[model samples]
Target: MEIAIILISALICMSVVAIKLSDTKLSFPFAMKKQLFTAAERQFLMLIERAVGNEFRVLCRVRLIDLLSLKTDTNKKLANSALLKAGNKHIDFVLCDKNDLTPVMAIDLVYGAGKDGHNVQRDFFVNGALDTASIPHVRIKAKNGYTLAEIRECIETKLIPLRRRQGKIPFVAANDRPEVIKRSTKPTRPLSTSRKAVA
Candidate 1:
């Protein structure tokens, strides 16, 4: 009877051990981030929405590769290097055409970048890449009390002209209606150029 009891106890211990092991093995190391944007980012996004109105769609944390493509004839090794360099990097925000979702400009939120060499270098690479592609990149200082008119000015004064030089004309009417909304109609793209600081 004691032997049988001992065997039963051993079986119960083994079962407990197995259950513990299974629970440990199935446990995940991740928890929900529970947020898509930081408080600052969310506030800025709201400002951009008000600033651009319905003319543009603001995309956040857009990867660099998503905004640019390498030349077809370039060497394989160099292409890989370039791709790897930009693959993980991202623009803070990108303004795309609302109708076609075409990327029109890049915007980075800046907060006294002179102190950070890493950020400065990163911006240099991003600026050079966007400049090469003729895409307008606007750096806006992070602060409170930004008016809608100021953001609108950035798009009108910088984003529009840069794309115009590339023959990518973007048309928008003051009536809160974009000309491209009429699918049967087509027009040239837009252009813009500027790197102004709004104090």
Candidate 2:
């Protein structure tokens, strides 16, 4: 009985030591810090927020994989290809339906004419993916501060046609139309000069 009790005590000590060693081995270092957005991106997001108001939700730096999915069946090759194409890419901004969070439009802020070869290739790939998925996309130049009217114009010109093609009408409810009319009739506020140009 004495020997058994000693062995039991030894076993408990060993177990405690093993647990501590495992915890020490598994410990990892991590840094928690604040992430700063670019000045241009900040300004752009502000513009998008003001332009969309309460009508739509604007999501910034959304991953392509989150927005897109493999439409094909369980073919491994096709699935892998789709993943490879979308895995590392992200859209600058995505306008989503306020009610259901369904993606309505994707906007990419292009600096200059996108003359860089890498940028051109990336643009082609992103545009192709959006087009193949039947998602409307607009490439806006990173110019001096964009006005609310200009942003609305871009949506009307680029997204409305796509929405129509998909048989989706904007604000179909009679009650919703009145709110839109009321908002449209309101005077437009001038954009601030301090707004930064998007890069």
Candidate 3:
């Protein structure tokens, strides 16, 4: 009877794995999302792009692992545990330095005031990680009406100055936010109307 029971258990486990294998082979009922960002997110992204100007490049939907990693001294087991705990969590947007693509600031778009404790804890972890790395974290409320000036003030006036003092931002950037300089291309020499130059 004990042997029969053991055989039955083995069969049940095999059946379970077989079912899982078949499920994995089947195509999931997935549909492609129509848009990556909602209208509000798109608006905020546009504001960030315009506000930071050509100084910084903006990246969206970046994973935390992509931005940060555990210290080298961390043991493999501890590292795996920490990574497993935080894996798959992502930042909404990351602003990077244009020169070497270093992550300058991490931005989270606050959709609404409806966050629960879990979200608060997750944000705490993310913010703490950014702080540990000396990278600034900014949370901007999602609004349809974010002006370029307001975003610029938050980034340039507030965050950039602090990072600049800390030497996080490279001194290569100008004191003033660099603007596109338009040089009107005029003929170096006046075009002679007479065709005699062709001879």
lDDT tens readout by residue for model 1, 1-199? 9999999999999999999999999999998899987676788899888888888899998999999999989899999988998897788889898889988889887765443322543467788889999888888877777888887887677866755665787556488664554564668665653666679
lDDT winner: 1
TM-score of each: 0.64, 0.64, 0.64
**Lowest-scoring 10 consecutive residues by lDDT in candidate 2?**
113-122
Q: Over the full model, what C-alpha lDDT does candidate 2 score relative to the true structure?
A: 0.80
Worst 10 residues of 3 by lDDT: 113-122
Q: Please state the error at residue 11 of candidate 2 in Å.
A: 5.0
The collision pairs in model 3 are: none
Judged by lDDT against the true structure, how good is candidate 3? 0.80
| Tens-digit lDDT string for candidate 3 (100-189) | 999988888875654432143337778777888878888777666777888888877557666677788867747667788988798576
Q: Which segments of candidate 1 are over 4 A away from where they belong?
A: 1-27, 113-122, 162-199
Candidate 2 residue spans exceeding 4 A from truth: 1-17, 24-28, 111-121, 162-199
What lDDT tens digits, residue by residue, belong to model 2 across residues 41-80?
7788888888878988999888889988777565998789
RMSD of 1: 17.7
User: How many clashes (backbone N, Cα, C below 3 Å) per candidate?
Assistant: 17, 0, 0
